[model samples]
Target: MKKDKEKVLDEVWTEDRVREFLASEPKAGTDADFHALLKAYQSMRADDFELFIGMFLETNRNLNATDKAGRTVLSYAKEHRNSGEHVAALEAKGAL
Candidate 1:
């Protein structure tokens, strides 16, 4: 059991893994997908979050997706504490 836990922790998130995870998700360009990404972004560390975003873009996921209220990932990052790196990453991707 301990070894299983350790192995799980040792697992690295790959581009294929990211893509697989998104496969069952709502359409890539949908608001639901954007919201899902936002939730993941809020939970991840800056580096991992950046990688996720890169994978998202590589899969042709929406970069400038917005919520029903028109709130975007950038706007959420700006509102989040210690999210400067996240904001920068999103901005570098032309998120608005």
Candidate 2:
């Protein structure tokens, strides 16, 4: 089966655009910080995720925020098959 949408690998991400992910809000009862981190991880490349982490910490956001299920971004990243670099980035920032 052919997919209708094509994947974009080298999409340009500027600082402003990368910083925008910091404002991502979560659904009710979900952790805001976790949602932001997950969204940034899902959207940005590894380098951009690393850059976002810096800005996230500068704003005093929680790097260890957990979802309703108590799963941190690091926990989720560990489960993802392609998230090795993302996991490393999260760990370097001391995310639990």
Candidate 3:
């Protein structure tokens, strides 16, 4: 039970906010915008990284590949203490 609770904590997510933000995109723009969205989403839920990681990986070929916003995955994660898992997920997806 303790381990289960810890895993849930490591999961890190404020689901409602993250979902709403992701759903509110313009649908077409520079990869920078997409990166920003992913950055923001990951910041919210380090554990619930599926949405952002999947978004990037699914469109890997189309992704910006560079964070023009001058932010790195770890840098963004620094803003959200709960985002450790999210940072890991983004790294797995190849977000620089």
The deviation in Å at residue 93 for candidate 3 is 1.7
Q: If ranked by TM-score, best first, what sequence of candidates would result?
A: 2, 1, 3
Using lDDT, give the best candidate's number.
2
Number of clashing pairs, model 2?
0
lDDT (Cα, tens digit) per residue for candidate 2, span 4-96: 999887999999999999899789988889999989988888999999999999999999999888889899889989999999999999988
- For candidate 2, give the lDDT of residue 93: 92
Candidate 3's TM-score reads: 0.44
Q: List the residue pairs that clash in candidate 3.
A: 11-47, 46-86
The global Cα lDDT (0 to 1) of model 1 is: 0.72
Clash pairs (backbone) in predicted model 2: none
- Model 3 over residues 1-96: C-alpha lDDT tens digits? 355444344444455655544454442543555555555664555445556556545544322343556555455665876666766766676566
lDDT of 1 by residue, 33-72 (tens): 6765776676566677787787788778887778777878
Q: Model 3, 29: alpha-carbon shift in Å?
A: 10
RMSD of each: 4.5, 2.2, 8.6
Question: lDDT (CA) for every model shown?
Answer: 0.72, 0.92, 0.54
